[model samples]
Target: MSRFTTACIVGGLAAASAFASTPAQAGYYILRWDNTGICQVWSEAFTFKPIRWPSGYKIVSRPVPTFNEAVNLQVRLRRQGRCTL
Candidate 1:
């Protein structure tokens, strides 16, 4: 291959490898009890399967908001009589 072509291929491979090696940003969520609207817990990371949350609890996906916002929302929801432990 030409020198320029070889350089381009190598650079492209390097960039691809770098991107592939980087880890994806994880999402956070809250699990609030359906009956009480007071008992709430934060998940360690996002998941599809049922987490270890107690029975009658619902998952609140908070993937876009900041961590503080997620926590605050959970507290606010509980205070507003939305859900409980």
Candidate 2:
């Protein structure tokens, strides 16, 4: 690729990264399927509650990258004996 094209791509990526880093208002907890257990969820909306979880669950911010990360967070929270709904 030409130098100009490369520069534009890099610049665009930088701008996107900066925007992604900017903080936004917190949203309500939304539940997705926890494959670590036995649930196969089709929807990705948690009922708007005060965000409660069992001893092994954690209520993390929504929009996690992957299902595995969500499950890991849940497991960690459960390990800590904290409610993470």
Estimated TM-score per prediction? 0.47, 0.29
Badly placed stretches (over 4 Å) of model 2 are 1-62
- lDDT by residue (1-85, candidate 2, tens digit) is 9999999999999999999998653333324323233222111444344333442323344545556666665566556644333
The list of candidate 1 runs beyond 4 A from truth reads 1-20, 39-41, 44-54
Q: Lowest lDDT 10-mer window, candidate 1?
A: 38-47
Best by TM-score: 1
For each candidate in turn, give its C-alpha RMSD to the true structure in angstroms: 5.1, 9.7
lDDT of 1 by residue, 1-85 (tens): 9999999999999999999999766555676665555545454554565545555666764554457767777777667766553
